[model samples]
Target: MKIALIAHDKKKEELLDFVSKHKDVFSQHELFATGTTGLRVNERTELPIHRFKSGPLGGDQEIGARIANQELDAVFFFRDPLTAQPHEPDVSALIRLGDVYRIPMATNIGMAQILIHAIRRNEF
Candidate 1:
């Protein structure tokens, strides 16, 4: 499976923690992430990751391309709804592409954990 991870500035630590706790499960698959989030996650776990540009700088589009190409299996996008983003369209497109591609996507922590757990349990 190929998993793409993205986190808003405020959720980076939480995302990193989640990845660290589930390193074993994540290690079995390929990982992709936006620049700073990937760097933060790498600091906490050994999961191999392909890093893209920062979300505001084209990372969302990079990941969106993979989703459109049917190259991604799942996505965890930890967006901060309370804060407005400069790249709203890119973010929206990524979310929309995930839906069009039928790939599982989690925009918050609860859903992210649920999806990861389901994948680990072979319930997908």
Candidate 2:
């Protein structure tokens, strides 16, 4: 399974922790992430991840393209809904693409936990 891991600035740590908690499952699949998130996740978990531009700099679009191309199986996007975002449209577009493609998407940690378990069991 190819999964994209994404998070807003305020949610990066939470996403990182979630990924770490599920490293065994995640390590079995291909991982993709935006620039800083990828870098930090790699540094902490040492998981090989394909990195793209930062979200504000087009990473969301890059991942959205992957979704459109069927290059991604699932998405774990830990969005910070409370805070205003500069790239709101891009974020919305990414989520919309996920929905359009019927790809599994987890926008919060609780949902992410379910997705991670499904991944572990090869449910997706």
Candidate 3:
């Protein structure tokens, strides 16, 4: 499976920790992530990741394109909803594209945990 990861600036550390805990499972599949998120995740996990530009710099669009082409199997986007994002449209498109393509998407830590656990159990 090809998993794409994206997280807002404030949620980067959370995403990194999440990936670290689940590295055993995640190591078996391909990983992709936005710039800073990918770098942070790579710092703690051995997963090979394809890093795109920063989200505000078109990384969201890059991931959106992959989703649209059915190149992604799942996405874990840890968004900070309480904060305003300058690239809201791109973020929204990524979510919409995931749904339209029938891909699994987790917008928050709770949902992301569920999906990751399910994957571990081979339920996905």
Candidate 4:
């Protein structure tokens, strides 16, 4: 499965921790992420990840394209809803694409936990 790991600035640490916790499972799949988030996850977890541009610089759209192409199986996007993002429209478009494509997406820790387990169980 091809999994995308993305997070807003405020939620990067949380996503990193989640990745770390599930390194064994994640190691079995291909991983992709936005620039800074990818770098941080790779550095901390030693997981090989394909890195795209920063989100504000078009990373979300890049991932969305992959979704549209049926190249991505799941998305773990840890969004920071409380903060205002300069690339808000891009983010919305990405989420919209996910829904339109019927791609499973996790936008928070709770949803992520469920999705990760489902992946682990080979349920999707």
Candidate 5:
């Protein structure tokens, strides 16, 4: 399965920690992520991830395109709802595309845990 990992600035650490905790599970699949988030995760966990542009710089749209093409199996986006994003529309579009494609997505740690477990069980 192809999975994407994304997170807002304030939530990057949380996302990183979650990824670290699930590294064993995640290592079995192909990974993709936005620029800074990808860099940080790779730096810490040494996971080989395909990196896209920064979210504000078109990463979300790139991932959305993949969703439209049915290339991605799941998305783990740790959005910071309390903060204002400069490219809010792109984020919304990505979420909408995920829904349209019926892709599994987790915007928080709890949901992410479920998705990871599902993956572990070969449910996808």
Candidate 6:
């Protein structure tokens, strides 16, 4: 399965920790992420990930395009809802596209854990 990993600035560390904890599970699949997030995950986990541009610079749109084309199987987006984002519209569009395509997505750590477990069990 192709899995996308994304995190807002404040949530990057949390996402990284989650990914690290699940590195064994994640290592079995293809991973994709936005620029800084991807770089950090790769550096910390040594997981090979395809990196897109920074979200404000079009990464969310890039991921959304994949969702539209049915290329991604799941998305793990650790969004920081309390903060204002400059690319809020793009983020909304990406989430909308995920729903439109019926792709499974997790916007928080709890949901992400469930999704990852589901993937492991071949529930999807």
Listed per candidate, the RMSD to the true structure in angstroms reads: 0.8, 0.6, 0.8, 0.4, 0.5, 0.6
lDDT of 4 by residue, 22-119 (tens): 99999999999999999999999999999999999999999999999999999999999999999999999999999999999999999999999999
Instruction: Indicate the TM-score of model 6.
Output: 0.98
State which candidate, 2 or 6, has the greater lDDT: 6
Clash list (residue pairs), candidate 2: none
Model 2 over residues 6-99: C-alpha lDDT tens digits? 9999999999999899999989989999999999999999999999999999999999999999999999999999999999999999999999
Model 5 over residues 22-101: C-alpha lDDT tens digits? 99998999999999999999999999999999999999999999999999999999999999999999999999999999
**Candidate 1, TM-score vs. the true structure?**
0.97
Superposed by TM-score, candidate 4 places the C-alpha of residue 68 at a distance from the truth, in angstroms, of 0.8
Q: Write model 6 residue lDDT over 56-85, tens digit each, in one string.
A: 999999999999999999999999999999
Q: How does candidate 2 fare on TM-score?
A: 0.98
lDDT of 1 at 81: 95
Weakest ten-residue segment in model 5 by summed lDDT: 115-124
lDDT of 1 by residue, 8-122 (tens): 9998988888888888999998999999999888777866799999999999999999999999999999999999999999999999999888999999999998999999999
Error of 3 at 21 (Å): 0.5
- State the displacement of the C-alpha of residue 31, model 3, in Å, after optimal TM-score superposition: 0.1
lDDT of 3 by residue, 49-119 (tens): 99999999999999999999989999999999999999999999988898899999998999999999999
Distance from true location, Cα of 64 in model 4, Å: 0.6
Q: Which stretches in model 3 have alpha-carbon errors above 4 Å? A: none
How high a TM-score does candidate 3 get? 0.97
lDDT of 6: 0.96
Q: Which ten residues in a row have the lowest lDDT in candidate 4?
A: 115-124
Top of the candidates by lDDT:
4
